[model samples]
Target: MTALGELQRLRASRGGPPRKRENKAAFLFLLPWFAGLLLITAGPIAVSLVLGFTDYNLIQPPEFNGLDNFNRMLSDERLHSALRVTFTYVLVSVPLQLACALGLALLLDRGLRGLSFYRSAFYLPSLLGSSVAIAVLWQQIFGAEGMVNQVLGLIGVQGRGWISDPSTALSTLIVLNVWTFGAPMVIFLAGLRQIPVMYYEAAAVDGANRWTQFRKITVPLLSPIIFFNLVLQVIHAFQSFTQAFVVSGGSGGPSDSTLFYTLYLYQRGFNNFDMGYASALAWLLLVIIAGFTAVNFWAAKRWVFYDD
Candidate 1:
């Protein structure tokens, strides 16, 4: 029976038409992703784009008002203030974060004792940075009678509320942004380790000092990694939310100094019940970030280098 079945199967295989090489496995794997892309991402994006031109506040039916939202945003005082604060935060925080990250990475890359322990310790903050608990901790640390003021009291230097004083509130958030540089520090460390020892040795043989080697070889080779970190950090800084959200008590107060763009969108959509305006704001932010990323890539041609 087995022999007869095998003979029949062989005959069937020989007589059958050539099978189509369908990519069933690849199609199956992509099915769930495609569904998610359509439902979660693409669907909402389309809805938001439509809402950007309407006057829907989630309670009333949407009424088409082409260009009105954009024009209103142009004349909006609160949006301008939010934009100023957001830009200030991005400009100050991103570069300082990258600089601090690079510095720490260089320090850690020097074959320190218990390097793993130090690495984990440094990375702990990045993990906790977005947590409400950490934001609350930051609030306490920068509050009127918080630890910073206590330290200041010991030194007899008058201390205002770090999170309440408009002048210091934004700067405190910038410091918070810089303090979470550990993730970038780890990336920089990995990039540093990828540098071949031969390059340094060859430079040394030619009488190149450490600074000279770093300038000529280390920096140039690491330029790609630096550029990657810079772009990522800038985007993250621009979209910062939790720290300011918690510190400002969800009101973006202290005279709106910490009113980040995202926070403002939340204020409009949720608090003020203006979903259409918030959607428009969100689209504008998306465009701003896209423009910034595009400009960075354009400028990167001059500064960012690739190894041959």
Candidate 2:
């Protein structure tokens, strides 16, 4: 029989089209989200790509600048600083956040008492840490005569302005980012629960120590989750804006020490009214993030384990 005839016969033998009742219901439920995705998400991206090639500020008509904005990045000193700060934050914060997340996940996996409460308490920071109010609170806590300094006074160790010093401002933000490890920790906990109890029991029968079992079994089994979180957290860290913006009072000050890439893009687009340059910067960020994510996927082949 011909391929199409055979496929039709096979389908005829099993069933016709699926019932539309449940499918129609699901589509109805999803309509709002789909509409939002098209209007809120996809629409802006199309406009921004066109903006990247223009010289429009809010006051003037958009004049095509071709590759001018992209080319200017080659010699832009502030762009370089923004890139360096962003890279440092991503490199330092992501690994530290993952490590803290993994550690907390492992702890919670031991089936401790009040597990829900502990998990909720740990995850609370991730829920609220990125809010403007939280960032403002962080600024106050890290100020020279703030809570940190007051605690230091108790120990007779004088404290410096953690968020005001050029050298230390970014570090404080890194800590803030790291403190929100609860999200990944929750994901890791879920991954841990999925592991078969029989695997650990089998390892125990072979006289494996806790360390050995964790190293050989838990680590291998959790590699896929680790890879997932790594990619997500890296992109998240690189795009961080609100914390740095609030901490530095939207100036990225203390010598531009907290100049995250997104903050710099905002400074160019809105503050300086250089919308074209800001749009270019936004696309540049997408390219950088895409490159890193591609590398991560390529690297995953070596370590990420799947059961097929």
Candidate 3:
């Protein structure tokens, strides 16, 4: 046969050009998410990176300032204070929040009465945690004449304006952050439920106490879930803006005690119209979060037990 005829015969024997129907279906399904990533996410990130090296206010065109913004941070006392506040908040709130969540999840895992109601009630705070209304409510709750002081008054323990005192203002915010433990609680409950009951039974037959089993089996198995929540909460805490902003009344006030990193960035960007500096701050935050996350993943190898 001629070469062309042989190729045609081979094609006929096998199949036509691959249609890639599955790939096309997957691409179709993923189109919206891909579009969002490019436009809403990646686009802004790229623009912000470029803007970080340039001086730009909303009223003027950007002028390249090289590393001025980053350099300015070296001498910025406010930036240091903001970083201190942010790190303190994250370090304190995340572990406490996770602890509260795990404790409540354990309590709920005991097959208690009205379990659904308890779960819903506990989770309600997380739903409203980031809302302006919640922050406003928090301000009232901790205000001198607010509910907290009112209770204190009955107990004859005088209270000051919790949100207005630099010393106590940050603590109130920390308390607020800790109160929103519901989301992680749910995750813990799910992880707890996933543990095979037989493991507990086996441990019991081996005369292992509750603490022993919990330390050995529960902690090891649940380490993965704990790691996941840790990473997410750390990132969330770093990016927190609304609570501090609303509570501080957009001032990061009471002696800058509530000046979270994101709040400082917002003040710089919009309030001061220092978009370039704000972009730099944003980039710094991105680096910090990425570094922490990388460390967490690295550290996970030592502790997080995966069944894989």
lDDT of 1: 0.87
Angstrom error at residue 268, model 1: 0.8
**177-285, model 3: which lDDT tens digit per residue?**
9999999999899889889989999999999999999999899989888988898899989988999998888989889999999999989998899999898898899
Name the candidate, 1 or 2, with the larger TM-score value: 1
RMSD of each: 10.6, 6.8, 9.8
Q: What TM-score against the true fold does each predicted structure earn?
A: 0.91, 0.88, 0.90
Quantify all predictions' global Cα lDDT against the true fold: 0.87, 0.90, 0.90
For candidate 2, give the lDDT of residue 299.
92
Assess candidate 2 and give its lDDT.
0.90
Residue pairs in collision within model 3:
none
Show the colliding residue pairs in model 2. Answer: none
**Poorest 10 consecutive residues of model 2 by lDDT?**
1-10
Regions of model 3 farther than 4 Å from truth? 1-28
lDDT of 1 by residue, 1-308 (tens): 22323543475575568777668987898999989988999888888989999998777899999999999998998899899999999988899989988888888886789889989988888888888998899899888999999999999998988888888899988888888989998989988988998999999999999899989998998887888888788888888999889999998888899999999999999998787888899899989998988888778879877664
